[model samples]
Target: MRAADPALDSLQGLALGDAFGDRWFSVPIDELSDALAVRTLRPAPWPWTDDTAMALVLVRHLITWGEVRQDALAGDFAAEYGREYHRDYGPAMHRVLRGIGSGGDWRAITSSQFEGHGSYGNGAAMRVAPLGAWFADDLDETVRQAELQALTTHFHPEAVAGAVAVALAAALAVRTRGRRAPGRAELLTEIAGRLPDSEVRSGLRIAARMPDRTSVRHAAAVLGSGLLISAPDTVPFALWSAAGHLDSLPEAIWHTVAGGGDTDTTCAIAAGVVAARTGLADVPPAWLAAREELPDWVAEVSTSS
Candidate 1:
Protein backbone atom coordinates (compact mmCIF):
# COMPACT_ATOMS: atom_id res chain seq x y z
CA MET A 1 0.00 0.00 0.00
CA ARG A 2 1.12 3.56 -0.64
CA ALA A 3 1.85 5.98 2.20
CA ALA A 4 -1.42 7.75 1.44
CA ASP A 5 -3.36 4.52 1.76
CA PRO A 6 -3.55 4.65 5.55
CA ALA A 7 -5.44 7.96 5.50
CA LEU A 8 -7.81 6.76 2.81
CA ASP A 9 -8.25 3.48 4.61
CA SER A 10 -9.01 5.24 7.84
CA LEU A 11 -11.57 7.43 6.08
CA GLN A 12 -13.29 4.38 4.61
CA GLY A 13 -13.40 2.62 7.93
CA LEU A 14 -14.70 5.67 9.73
CA ALA A 15 -17.44 6.22 7.20
CA LEU A 16 -18.50 2.60 7.14
CA GLY A 17 -18.55 2.38 10.89
CA ASP A 18 -20.53 5.61 11.12
CA ALA A 19 -23.09 4.35 8.64
CA PHE A 20 -23.31 0.92 10.22
CA GLY A 21 -23.76 2.27 13.70
CA ASP A 22 -26.50 4.66 12.57
CA ARG A 23 -28.62 1.69 11.57
CA TRP A 24 -29.05 0.81 15.21
CA PHE A 25 -31.20 3.85 15.82
CA SER A 26 -33.80 2.48 13.45
CA VAL A 27 -34.28 -0.64 15.51
CA PRO A 28 -37.32 -0.61 17.78
CA ILE A 29 -36.50 0.29 21.36
CA ASP A 30 -37.65 -3.07 22.68
CA GLU A 31 -35.72 -5.08 20.08
CA LEU A 32 -32.61 -2.96 20.48
CA SER A 33 -31.18 -5.13 23.19
CA ASP A 34 -31.60 -8.33 21.23
CA ALA A 35 -30.39 -6.68 18.03
CA LEU A 36 -27.23 -5.49 19.73
CA ALA A 37 -26.54 -8.80 21.36
CA VAL A 38 -27.18 -11.02 18.34
CA ARG A 39 -25.83 -8.60 15.75
CA THR A 40 -28.96 -9.40 13.75
CA LEU A 41 -29.87 -5.90 12.65
CA ARG A 42 -29.35 -5.71 8.92
CA PRO A 43 -30.38 -2.38 7.61
CA ALA A 44 -29.54 -1.86 3.99
CA PRO A 45 -27.99 1.21 2.39
CA TRP A 46 -26.65 2.37 5.73
CA PRO A 47 -26.29 6.10 5.36
CA TRP A 48 -23.53 7.83 7.26
CA THR A 49 -24.23 10.78 9.54
CA ASP A 50 -22.45 14.10 10.13
CA ASP A 51 -19.43 12.19 11.36
CA THR A 52 -18.65 10.95 7.87
CA ALA A 53 -19.84 14.14 6.24
CA MET A 54 -17.36 16.30 8.19
CA ALA A 55 -14.67 13.66 7.89
CA LEU A 56 -14.99 13.71 4.11
CA VAL A 57 -14.43 17.45 4.12
CA LEU A 58 -11.35 17.12 6.29
CA VAL A 59 -9.87 14.32 4.15
CA ARG A 60 -10.39 16.21 0.90
CA HIS A 61 -8.88 19.39 2.33
CA LEU A 62 -5.77 17.54 3.51
CA ILE A 63 -5.39 15.70 0.21
CA THR A 64 -5.57 18.92 -1.76
CA TRP A 65 -3.35 21.09 0.47
CA GLY A 66 -0.92 18.41 1.76
CA GLU A 67 -1.56 19.89 5.21
CA VAL A 68 -4.38 21.47 7.17
CA ARG A 69 -5.07 25.09 6.22
CA GLN A 70 -7.47 26.20 8.92
CA ASP A 71 -9.46 28.86 7.06
CA ALA A 72 -9.85 26.71 3.99
CA LEU A 73 -10.80 23.76 6.13
CA ALA A 74 -13.44 25.80 7.92
CA GLY A 75 -14.79 26.97 4.58
CA ASP A 76 -14.90 23.42 3.28
CA PHE A 77 -16.65 22.23 6.43
CA ALA A 78 -19.28 24.92 6.16
CA ALA A 79 -19.74 24.24 2.47
CA GLU A 80 -20.05 20.51 2.99
CA TYR A 81 -22.49 20.97 5.82
CA GLY A 82 -24.57 23.22 3.57
CA ARG A 83 -24.48 20.75 0.72
CA GLU A 84 -25.48 17.85 2.95
CA TYR A 85 -27.81 19.49 5.41
CA HIS A 86 -29.81 16.29 5.97
CA ARG A 87 -26.94 14.45 7.63
CA ASP A 88 -28.26 14.87 11.19
CA TYR A 89 -25.86 17.57 12.37
CA GLY A 90 -26.35 18.73 15.95
CA PRO A 91 -28.32 21.96 16.31
CA ALA A 92 -25.39 24.01 17.61
CA MET A 93 -23.14 22.81 14.78
CA HIS A 94 -25.90 23.36 12.27
CA ARG A 95 -26.20 26.92 13.52
CA VAL A 96 -22.45 27.50 13.50
CA LEU A 97 -21.94 26.14 10.00
CA ARG A 98 -24.96 28.01 8.65
CA GLY A 99 -23.56 31.17 10.16
CA ILE A 100 -20.26 30.54 8.40
CA GLY A 101 -22.04 29.89 5.10
CA SER A 102 -23.69 33.29 5.39
CA GLY A 103 -20.29 35.02 5.53
CA GLY A 104 -20.06 35.22 9.32
CA ASP A 105 -16.64 34.95 10.91
CA TRP A 106 -15.89 31.32 11.75
CA ARG A 107 -13.74 32.29 14.71
CA ALA A 108 -16.53 34.40 16.20
CA ILE A 109 -19.29 31.89 15.56
CA THR A 110 -17.26 28.89 16.71
CA SER A 111 -15.94 30.55 19.85
CA SER A 112 -19.38 31.87 20.73
CA GLN A 113 -20.87 28.38 21.04
CA PHE A 114 -22.55 27.41 24.32
CA GLU A 115 -22.64 30.94 25.72
CA GLY A 116 -18.95 31.50 24.89
CA HIS A 117 -17.74 28.47 26.76
CA GLY A 118 -17.30 26.99 23.27
CA SER A 119 -18.41 23.51 22.26
CA TYR A 120 -16.93 20.58 24.10
CA GLY A 121 -18.73 18.25 21.70
CA ASN A 122 -17.09 15.21 20.12
CA GLY A 123 -17.58 16.71 16.65
CA ALA A 124 -13.91 17.66 16.63
CA ALA A 125 -12.72 14.18 17.51
CA MET A 126 -15.10 12.44 15.11
CA ARG A 127 -13.49 13.90 11.98
CA VAL A 128 -9.77 13.92 12.84
CA ALA A 129 -8.49 10.36 12.50
CA PRO A 130 -7.48 10.60 8.85
CA LEU A 131 -5.48 13.71 9.62
CA GLY A 132 -3.59 11.65 12.15
CA ALA A 133 -3.03 8.88 9.60
CA TRP A 134 -1.83 11.40 7.02
CA PHE A 135 0.78 12.78 9.42
CA ALA A 136 1.65 9.46 10.97
CA ASP A 137 5.37 10.03 10.83
CA ASP A 138 5.26 13.11 13.08
CA LEU A 139 3.33 12.74 16.31
CA ASP A 140 3.94 16.40 17.15
CA GLU A 141 2.52 17.56 13.83
CA THR A 142 -0.46 15.23 14.20
CA VAL A 143 -1.40 16.74 17.58
CA ARG A 144 -0.78 20.26 16.29
CA GLN A 145 -2.91 19.78 13.19
CA ALA A 146 -5.65 18.03 15.17
CA GLU A 147 -5.93 21.05 17.49
CA LEU A 148 -5.98 23.44 14.55
CA GLN A 149 -8.69 21.46 12.82
CA ALA A 150 -10.70 21.21 16.03
CA LEU A 151 -10.37 24.97 16.54
CA THR A 152 -12.02 25.55 13.18
CA THR A 153 -15.35 24.60 14.78
CA HIS A 154 -14.57 23.70 18.39
CA PHE A 155 -12.62 25.94 20.75
CA HIS A 156 -13.02 24.23 24.09
CA PRO A 157 -9.85 22.79 25.62
CA GLU A 158 -11.61 19.47 26.16
CA ALA A 159 -12.75 19.31 22.53
CA VAL A 160 -9.23 20.01 21.28
CA ALA A 161 -7.91 17.38 23.69
CA GLY A 162 -10.34 14.82 22.27
CA ALA A 163 -9.13 15.54 18.75
CA VAL A 164 -5.52 15.24 19.88
CA ALA A 165 -6.20 11.92 21.58
CA VAL A 166 -7.97 10.39 18.55
CA ALA A 167 -5.41 11.75 16.09
CA LEU A 168 -2.52 10.39 18.15
CA ALA A 169 -4.26 7.04 18.38
CA ALA A 170 -4.51 6.87 14.59
CA ALA A 171 -0.92 8.02 14.18
CA LEU A 172 0.28 5.46 16.68
CA ALA A 173 -1.69 2.75 14.91
CA VAL A 174 0.03 3.70 11.65
CA ARG A 175 3.43 4.02 13.31
CA THR A 176 3.15 0.69 15.07
CA ARG A 177 1.64 -1.32 12.20
CA GLY A 178 3.33 -4.69 11.69
CA ARG A 179 5.09 -4.36 15.03
CA ARG A 180 3.74 -6.10 18.09
CA ALA A 181 0.52 -4.20 18.89
CA PRO A 182 1.04 -1.68 21.63
CA GLY A 183 -0.51 -2.77 24.92
CA ARG A 184 -3.51 -0.90 26.42
CA ALA A 185 -1.36 0.84 29.02
CA GLU A 186 1.16 1.91 26.40
CA LEU A 187 -1.50 3.24 24.04
CA LEU A 188 -3.36 5.22 26.67
CA THR A 189 -0.20 6.55 28.33
CA GLU A 190 1.27 7.77 25.02
CA ILE A 191 -1.98 9.55 24.14
CA ALA A 192 -2.25 11.02 27.65
CA GLY A 193 1.28 12.37 27.41
CA ARG A 194 0.32 14.36 24.30
CA LEU A 195 -2.79 15.87 25.92
CA PRO A 196 -3.14 18.94 28.10
CA ASP A 197 -4.28 18.71 31.70
CA SER A 198 -8.09 18.49 31.52
CA GLU A 199 -10.97 16.13 32.18
CA VAL A 200 -10.22 14.45 28.86
CA ARG A 201 -6.63 13.90 29.96
CA SER A 202 -7.84 12.61 33.30
CA GLY A 203 -10.07 10.11 31.48
CA LEU A 204 -7.10 8.80 29.51
CA ARG A 205 -5.15 8.35 32.72
CA ILE A 206 -8.01 6.19 33.96
CA ALA A 207 -8.27 4.38 30.63
CA ALA A 208 -4.58 3.49 30.76
CA ARG A 209 -5.22 1.33 33.75
CA MET A 210 -8.32 -0.41 32.38
CA PRO A 211 -7.78 -4.07 31.67
CA ASP A 212 -8.23 -5.48 28.19
CA ARG A 213 -10.91 -7.88 29.36
CA THR A 214 -13.10 -5.16 30.80
CA SER A 215 -16.65 -5.37 29.44
CA VAL A 216 -18.02 -2.67 27.18
CA ARG A 217 -20.74 -1.87 29.73
CA HIS A 218 -18.19 -1.43 32.48
CA ALA A 219 -15.89 0.59 30.27
CA ALA A 220 -18.71 2.83 29.10
CA ALA A 221 -19.81 3.38 32.66
CA VAL A 222 -16.28 4.37 33.59
CA LEU A 223 -15.07 6.22 30.47
CA GLY A 224 -18.32 7.23 28.76
CA SER A 225 -19.25 6.85 25.07
CA GLY A 226 -20.36 10.36 24.27
CA LEU A 227 -23.56 9.56 26.23
CA LEU A 228 -23.50 13.24 27.07
CA ILE A 229 -22.07 14.12 23.62
CA SER A 230 -19.08 15.84 25.22
CA ALA A 231 -15.48 15.18 24.34
CA PRO A 232 -14.61 14.23 27.89
CA ASP A 233 -17.45 11.71 27.73
CA THR A 234 -16.42 10.20 24.40
CA VAL A 235 -12.75 10.15 23.47
CA PRO A 236 -11.41 7.92 26.19
CA PHE A 237 -13.82 5.02 25.64
CA ALA A 238 -13.42 5.18 21.87
CA LEU A 239 -9.66 5.12 22.28
CA TRP A 240 -9.94 2.29 24.76
CA SER A 241 -12.06 0.35 22.27
CA ALA A 242 -9.57 1.03 19.49
CA ALA A 243 -6.66 0.05 21.71
CA GLY A 244 -8.23 -3.22 22.71
CA HIS A 245 -9.15 -4.23 19.18
CA LEU A 246 -6.25 -2.75 17.23
CA ASP A 247 -6.12 -5.62 14.76
CA SER A 248 -9.85 -6.04 14.27
CA LEU A 249 -11.88 -3.29 12.72
CA PRO A 250 -15.22 -5.12 13.08
CA GLU A 251 -14.61 -6.04 16.69
CA ALA A 252 -13.57 -2.49 17.55
CA ILE A 253 -16.69 -1.09 15.92
CA TRP A 254 -18.89 -3.75 17.56
CA HIS A 255 -17.60 -2.93 21.02
CA THR A 256 -18.09 0.74 20.30
CA VAL A 257 -21.68 0.22 19.23
CA ALA A 258 -22.41 -2.03 22.18
CA GLY A 259 -21.37 0.73 24.52
CA GLY A 260 -24.54 2.55 23.29
CA GLY A 261 -24.23 6.38 23.42
CA ASP A 262 -23.55 8.34 20.25
CA THR A 263 -22.88 5.05 18.54
CA ASP A 264 -22.12 6.42 15.10
CA THR A 265 -19.53 8.92 16.30
CA THR A 266 -17.89 6.52 18.72
CA CYS A 267 -17.68 3.78 16.09
CA ALA A 268 -16.31 6.27 13.57
CA ILE A 269 -13.60 7.38 15.97
CA ALA A 270 -12.60 3.87 16.97
CA ALA A 271 -12.81 2.40 13.47
CA GLY A 272 -10.64 5.13 12.00
CA VAL A 273 -7.82 4.46 14.43
CA VAL A 274 -8.06 0.70 14.07
CA ALA A 275 -8.15 0.88 10.29
CA ALA A 276 -5.03 3.03 10.23
CA ARG A 277 -3.24 -0.21 10.96
CA THR A 278 -5.62 -2.93 9.73
CA GLY A 279 -7.12 -1.07 6.77
CA LEU A 280 -10.33 -2.51 5.20
CA ALA A 281 -8.84 -5.86 4.39
CA ASP A 282 -10.77 -7.57 7.16
CA VAL A 283 -13.96 -5.49 6.98
CA PRO A 284 -17.07 -7.44 6.10
CA PRO A 285 -17.80 -7.11 2.38
CA ALA A 286 -21.53 -6.87 2.99
CA TRP A 287 -21.13 -4.00 5.44
CA LEU A 288 -18.87 -2.07 3.09
CA ALA A 289 -21.30 -2.62 0.23
CA ALA A 290 -24.15 -1.23 2.31
CA ARG A 291 -22.47 2.04 3.17
CA GLU A 292 -23.48 5.03 1.10
CA GLU A 293 -20.91 6.10 -1.44
CA LEU A 294 -18.56 8.83 -0.29
CA PRO A 295 -18.72 12.21 -1.98
CA ASP A 296 -17.53 12.13 -5.57
CA TRP A 297 -14.58 14.41 -4.81
CA VAL A 298 -13.21 12.14 -2.06
CA ALA A 299 -13.91 9.04 -4.14
CA GLU A 300 -11.66 10.41 -6.86
CA VAL A 301 -8.91 11.11 -4.36
CA SER A 302 -9.13 7.64 -2.87
CA THR A 303 -8.69 6.00 -6.26
CA SER A 304 -5.63 8.07 -7.15
CA SER A 305 -2.06 6.83 -6.56
Candidate 2:
Protein backbone atom coordinates (compact mmCIF):
# COMPACT_ATOMS: atom_id res chain seq x y z
CA MET A 1 0.00 0.00 0.00
CA ARG A 2 1.69 3.13 -1.24
CA ALA A 3 1.23 6.34 0.68
CA ALA A 4 2.05 10.00 0.06
CA ASP A 5 5.41 10.60 -1.58
CA PRO A 6 7.31 11.84 1.44
CA ALA A 7 10.36 10.00 0.14
CA LEU A 8 10.47 12.45 -2.76
CA ASP A 9 10.39 15.22 -0.20
CA SER A 10 13.27 13.55 1.60
CA LEU A 11 15.22 13.28 -1.65
CA GLN A 12 14.80 16.99 -2.34
CA GLY A 13 15.91 17.82 1.16
CA LEU A 14 18.91 15.52 0.78
CA ALA A 15 19.87 17.19 -2.50
CA LEU A 16 19.52 20.68 -1.08
CA GLY A 17 21.69 19.77 1.86
CA ASP A 18 24.26 18.10 -0.37
CA ALA A 19 24.60 21.14 -2.63
CA PHE A 20 24.49 23.63 0.20
CA GLY A 21 27.13 21.81 2.17
CA ASP A 22 29.36 21.32 -0.87
CA ARG A 23 29.59 25.08 -1.36
CA TRP A 24 31.38 25.47 1.94
CA PHE A 25 34.27 23.44 0.58
CA SER A 26 34.94 26.26 -1.88
CA VAL A 27 35.25 29.00 0.73
CA PRO A 28 38.68 30.31 1.74
CA ILE A 29 39.81 28.78 5.03
CA ASP A 30 39.44 32.07 6.89
CA GLU A 31 36.26 33.01 5.08
CA LEU A 32 34.58 29.68 5.88
CA SER A 33 34.18 30.43 9.57
CA ASP A 34 33.01 33.98 8.92
CA ALA A 35 30.52 32.74 6.36
CA LEU A 36 29.14 30.13 8.70
CA ALA A 37 28.96 32.67 11.51
CA VAL A 38 26.87 35.05 9.42
CA ARG A 39 24.39 32.41 8.27
CA THR A 40 24.86 33.67 4.75
CA LEU A 41 23.19 31.58 2.11
CA ARG A 42 24.98 30.17 -0.91
CA PRO A 43 23.81 31.66 -4.19
CA ALA A 44 22.02 29.86 -7.02
CA PRO A 45 23.10 26.75 -8.94
CA TRP A 46 23.95 24.75 -5.84
CA PRO A 47 25.00 21.59 -7.59
CA TRP A 48 24.70 18.50 -5.40
CA THR A 49 27.39 15.86 -5.04
CA ASP A 50 27.64 12.08 -4.74
CA ASP A 51 25.22 11.96 -1.84
CA THR A 52 22.33 13.19 -3.98
CA ALA A 53 23.47 11.24 -7.01
CA MET A 54 23.48 7.90 -5.22
CA ALA A 55 20.24 8.76 -3.43
CA LEU A 56 18.53 9.37 -6.75
CA VAL A 57 19.62 5.94 -7.87
CA LEU A 58 18.22 4.44 -4.65
CA VAL A 59 14.88 6.21 -5.03
CA ARG A 60 14.60 5.02 -8.61
CA HIS A 61 15.36 1.52 -7.38
CA LEU A 62 12.56 1.66 -4.80
CA ILE A 63 10.14 3.04 -7.38
CA THR A 64 10.94 0.10 -9.62
CA TRP A 65 10.97 -2.69 -7.02
CA GLY A 66 9.34 -1.32 -3.83
CA GLU A 67 12.19 -2.88 -1.82
CA VAL A 68 15.84 -3.69 -2.16
CA ARG A 69 16.89 -6.32 -4.63
CA GLN A 70 20.57 -6.45 -3.89
CA ASP A 71 22.09 -7.72 -7.14
CA ALA A 72 20.10 -5.34 -9.26
CA LEU A 73 20.93 -2.53 -6.86
CA ALA A 74 24.63 -3.33 -7.12
CA GLY A 75 24.33 -3.13 -10.89
CA ASP A 76 22.34 0.10 -10.78
CA PHE A 77 24.93 1.68 -8.51
CA ALA A 78 27.64 0.81 -10.99
CA ALA A 79 25.61 2.01 -13.94
CA GLU A 80 24.83 5.33 -12.33
CA TYR A 81 28.48 5.84 -11.46
CA GLY A 82 29.46 4.87 -14.98
CA ARG A 83 27.25 7.60 -16.39
CA GLU A 84 28.32 10.32 -13.97
CA TYR A 85 31.68 9.88 -12.28
CA HIS A 86 32.01 13.59 -11.59
CA ARG A 87 29.60 13.78 -8.66
CA ASP A 88 32.45 14.20 -6.14
CA TYR A 89 32.24 10.56 -5.15
CA GLY A 90 34.71 9.42 -2.53
CA PRO A 91 37.92 7.91 -3.94
CA ALA A 92 37.05 4.48 -2.53
CA MET A 93 33.78 4.52 -4.46
CA HIS A 94 35.52 5.11 -7.78
CA ARG A 95 37.53 1.99 -7.14
CA VAL A 96 34.54 0.02 -5.85
CA LEU A 97 32.15 1.15 -8.56
CA ARG A 98 34.67 0.48 -11.29
CA GLY A 99 35.13 -3.03 -10.03
CA ILE A 100 31.38 -3.64 -9.87
CA GLY A 101 30.86 -2.04 -13.26
CA SER A 102 33.41 -4.36 -14.75
CA GLY A 103 31.18 -7.33 -13.84
CA GLY A 104 33.16 -8.24 -10.71
CA ASP A 105 31.08 -9.79 -7.93
CA TRP A 106 29.79 -6.89 -5.83
CA ARG A 107 30.23 -8.87 -2.66
CA ALA A 108 33.80 -9.76 -3.44
CA ILE A 109 34.67 -6.29 -4.70
CA THR A 110 32.97 -4.47 -1.83
CA SER A 111 34.11 -6.86 0.86
CA SER A 112 37.62 -6.38 -0.41
CA GLN A 113 37.63 -2.64 0.28
CA PHE A 114 39.64 -1.20 3.19
CA GLU A 115 42.03 -4.11 2.96
CA GLY A 116 39.34 -6.80 3.37
CA HIS A 117 37.74 -5.16 6.41
CA GLY A 118 35.18 -3.70 4.00
CA SER A 119 34.24 -0.05 4.01
CA TYR A 120 32.76 1.44 7.12
CA GLY A 121 32.58 4.74 5.26
CA ASN A 122 29.66 7.08 5.67
CA GLY A 123 28.63 6.55 2.04
CA ALA A 124 26.07 3.91 2.99
CA ALA A 125 24.37 6.20 5.46
CA MET A 126 24.56 9.37 3.33
CA ARG A 127 22.07 8.23 0.69
CA VAL A 128 19.56 6.12 2.61
CA ALA A 129 17.00 8.59 3.99
CA PRO A 130 14.48 8.25 1.18
CA LEU A 131 14.52 4.49 1.52
CA GLY A 132 13.73 4.98 5.18
CA ALA A 133 10.83 7.28 4.30
CA TRP A 134 9.61 4.75 1.78
CA PHE A 135 9.15 2.20 4.57
CA ALA A 136 8.38 4.65 7.31
CA ASP A 137 5.20 2.95 8.39
CA ASP A 138 6.94 -0.31 9.24
CA LEU A 139 10.24 0.14 10.99
CA ASP A 140 11.17 -3.53 10.96
CA GLU A 141 11.03 -3.49 7.21
CA THR A 142 12.84 -0.20 7.25
CA VAL A 143 15.83 -1.77 8.97
CA ARG A 144 15.60 -4.78 6.72
CA GLN A 145 15.63 -2.77 3.50
CA ALA A 146 18.25 -0.38 4.77
CA GLU A 147 20.65 -3.17 5.62
CA LEU A 148 20.17 -4.86 2.27
CA GLN A 149 20.80 -1.70 0.29
CA ALA A 150 23.86 -0.84 2.37
CA LEU A 151 25.32 -4.29 1.83
CA THR A 152 25.55 -3.62 -1.88
CA THR A 153 28.56 -1.38 -1.29
CA HIS A 154 29.50 -1.19 2.35
CA PHE A 155 29.90 -4.65 3.85
CA HIS A 156 31.22 -3.75 7.27
CA PRO A 157 28.98 -4.04 10.33
CA GLU A 158 29.54 -0.43 11.32
CA ALA A 159 28.61 0.76 7.86
CA VAL A 160 25.47 -1.35 7.95
CA ALA A 161 24.72 0.01 11.40
CA GLY A 162 25.08 3.57 10.15
CA ALA A 163 22.62 2.99 7.34
CA VAL A 164 20.11 1.41 9.70
CA ALA A 165 20.38 4.33 12.10
CA VAL A 166 19.75 7.01 9.46
CA ALA A 167 16.91 5.04 7.94
CA LEU A 168 15.29 4.65 11.33
CA ALA A 169 15.64 8.35 12.01
CA ALA A 170 13.97 9.26 8.73
CA ALA A 171 11.19 6.74 9.36
CA LEU A 172 10.46 8.14 12.79
CA ALA A 173 10.63 11.69 11.50
CA VAL A 174 7.98 10.92 8.91
CA ARG A 175 5.88 8.88 11.31
CA THR A 176 5.74 11.67 13.86
CA ARG A 177 5.17 14.59 11.51
CA GLY A 178 2.19 16.90 12.17
CA ARG A 179 2.01 15.26 15.55
CA ARG A 180 3.77 15.93 18.80
CA ALA A 181 7.47 15.54 18.16
CA PRO A 182 9.02 12.72 20.14
CA GLY A 183 11.41 13.54 22.95
CA ARG A 184 14.92 13.84 21.54
CA ALA A 185 16.35 11.49 24.11
CA GLU A 186 13.50 9.05 23.65
CA LEU A 187 13.74 9.18 19.87
CA LEU A 188 17.49 8.65 19.81
CA THR A 189 17.17 5.80 22.28
CA GLU A 190 14.59 4.07 20.13
CA ILE A 191 16.84 4.31 17.09
CA ALA A 192 19.85 3.18 19.04
CA GLY A 193 18.03 0.27 20.60
CA ARG A 194 17.15 -1.01 17.14
CA LEU A 195 20.72 -1.06 15.87
CA PRO A 196 23.58 -3.37 16.66
CA ASP A 197 26.11 -2.47 19.29
CA SER A 198 28.75 -0.48 17.43
CA GLU A 199 30.42 2.89 17.75
CA VAL A 200 27.66 4.42 15.65
CA ARG A 201 25.08 3.03 18.04
CA SER A 202 27.17 4.08 20.99
CA GLY A 203 27.44 7.60 19.61
CA LEU A 204 23.70 7.69 19.03
CA ARG A 205 23.22 6.69 22.65
CA ILE A 206 25.45 9.55 23.70
CA ALA A 207 23.57 11.88 21.40
CA ALA A 208 20.38 10.80 23.19
CA ARG A 209 21.80 11.95 26.48
CA MET A 210 23.15 15.33 25.40
CA PRO A 211 21.29 18.53 26.25
CA ASP A 212 19.37 19.83 23.25
CA ARG A 213 20.72 23.32 23.89
CA THR A 214 24.27 22.20 23.13
CA SER A 215 26.05 24.12 20.40
CA VAL A 216 26.58 22.43 17.04
CA ARG A 217 30.33 22.94 17.39
CA HIS A 218 30.34 21.23 20.76
CA ALA A 219 28.05 18.48 19.55
CA ALA A 220 30.15 17.87 16.46
CA ALA A 221 33.30 17.74 18.52
CA VAL A 222 31.68 15.13 20.74
CA LEU A 223 29.54 13.15 18.32
CA GLY A 224 31.57 14.04 15.26
CA SER A 225 30.41 15.62 12.00
CA GLY A 226 31.90 13.15 9.57
CA LEU A 227 35.48 14.33 9.98
CA LEU A 228 36.76 10.78 9.58
CA ILE A 229 34.25 10.01 6.81
CA SER A 230 33.53 6.74 8.62
CA ALA A 231 30.19 5.75 10.14
CA PRO A 232 31.30 6.01 13.76
CA ASP A 233 32.64 9.46 12.97
CA THR A 234 29.45 10.65 11.27
CA VAL A 235 25.98 9.15 11.77
CA PRO A 236 25.71 9.98 15.47
CA PHE A 237 26.09 13.71 14.86
CA ALA A 238 23.76 13.72 11.87
CA LEU A 239 21.04 11.98 13.88
CA TRP A 240 21.63 14.29 16.84
CA SER A 241 21.31 17.43 14.74
CA ALA A 242 18.25 16.06 13.01
CA ALA A 243 16.69 15.09 16.34
CA GLY A 244 17.24 18.61 17.62
CA HIS A 245 15.79 20.45 14.62
CA LEU A 246 13.09 18.18 13.29
CA ASP A 247 10.67 21.06 12.99
CA SER A 248 12.78 23.43 10.93
CA LEU A 249 14.31 22.41 7.59
CA PRO A 250 16.60 25.37 7.03
CA GLU A 251 17.75 25.62 10.60
CA ALA A 252 18.52 21.91 10.64
CA ILE A 253 20.75 22.23 7.60
CA TRP A 254 22.46 25.32 8.96
CA HIS A 255 23.05 23.73 12.30
CA THR A 256 24.33 20.55 10.73
CA VAL A 257 26.72 22.60 8.58
CA ALA A 258 28.18 24.32 11.61
CA GLY A 259 29.69 20.97 12.61
CA GLY A 260 32.17 21.33 9.69
CA GLY A 261 33.77 18.01 8.75
CA ASP A 262 32.03 16.07 6.03
CA THR A 263 29.53 18.90 5.92
CA ASP A 264 27.74 17.67 2.86
CA THR A 265 26.99 14.20 4.18
CA THR A 266 26.10 15.38 7.67
CA CYS A 267 23.83 18.10 6.30
CA ALA A 268 22.33 15.65 3.86
CA ILE A 269 21.53 13.22 6.66
CA ALA A 270 20.03 15.84 8.93
CA ALA A 271 18.15 17.66 6.19
CA GLY A 272 16.65 14.50 4.84
CA VAL A 273 15.41 13.49 8.27
CA VAL A 274 14.06 16.94 9.12
CA ALA A 275 12.38 17.34 5.74
CA ALA A 276 10.78 13.95 6.01
CA ARG A 277 8.78 15.59 8.76
CA THR A 278 8.58 19.26 7.68
CA GLY A 279 8.71 18.89 3.91
CA LEU A 280 9.67 22.06 1.98
CA ALA A 281 6.61 23.80 3.38
CA ASP A 282 8.79 25.86 5.70
CA VAL A 283 11.80 26.17 3.35
CA PRO A 284 12.11 29.62 1.80
CA PRO A 285 11.23 29.90 -1.87
CA ALA A 286 14.58 31.63 -2.44
CA TRP A 287 16.49 28.64 -1.08
CA LEU A 288 14.55 26.31 -3.32
CA ALA A 289 15.31 28.44 -6.34
CA ALA A 290 18.99 28.51 -5.45
CA ARG A 291 19.39 24.76 -5.44
CA GLU A 292 20.26 23.36 -8.84
CA GLU A 293 17.26 21.62 -10.36
CA LEU A 294 16.82 17.97 -9.50
CA PRO A 295 17.00 15.51 -12.34
CA ASP A 296 14.02 15.86 -14.66
CA TRP A 297 13.34 12.13 -14.47
CA VAL A 298 12.27 12.55 -10.84
CA ALA A 299 8.95 14.21 -11.64
CA GLU A 300 5.96 11.93 -11.21
CA VAL A 301 8.11 8.82 -11.24
CA SER A 302 5.70 5.90 -11.11
CA THR A 303 6.26 3.29 -8.38
CA SER A 304 6.14 0.33 -10.69
CA SER A 305 8.67 -1.73 -12.56
TM-score for every candidate vs. truth?
Answer: 0.96, 0.96
Q: After superposing candidate 2 on the true structure, give the runs of residues whose Cα lies further than 4 Å from its correct spot.
A: 1-4, 26-30, 302-305
* lDDT of each residue in 1-305, candidate 1, tens digit only: 26578999899999988998888754454576677688775669899999999998888788778888988988999999888999999988999899999999999999999999899999999989999999999999998999999999998999999999999999999998898899888999989987889999999999899877788888888999777999999999999888999989999888788887888899999999999999899987888888898878666666775
**Candidate lDDT (C-alpha), each:** 0.89, 0.89
Off by over 4 Å in 1: 26-30
In model 1, where is the ten-residue run with the lowest total lDDT? Answer: 25-34
Clashing residue pairs in candidate 2 are none
Best by lDDT: 2
State the TM-score for model 2: 0.96
Residue 106 displacement in candidate 1 (angstroms): 0.7
- Candidate 1 residue-wise lDDT at 18: 92
Q: What does candidate 2's lDDT look like per residue over 176-251, in tens digits?
A: 9789888889889999999988999999999999986888888889988887899999999998988888889999
RMSD of 1: 1.6
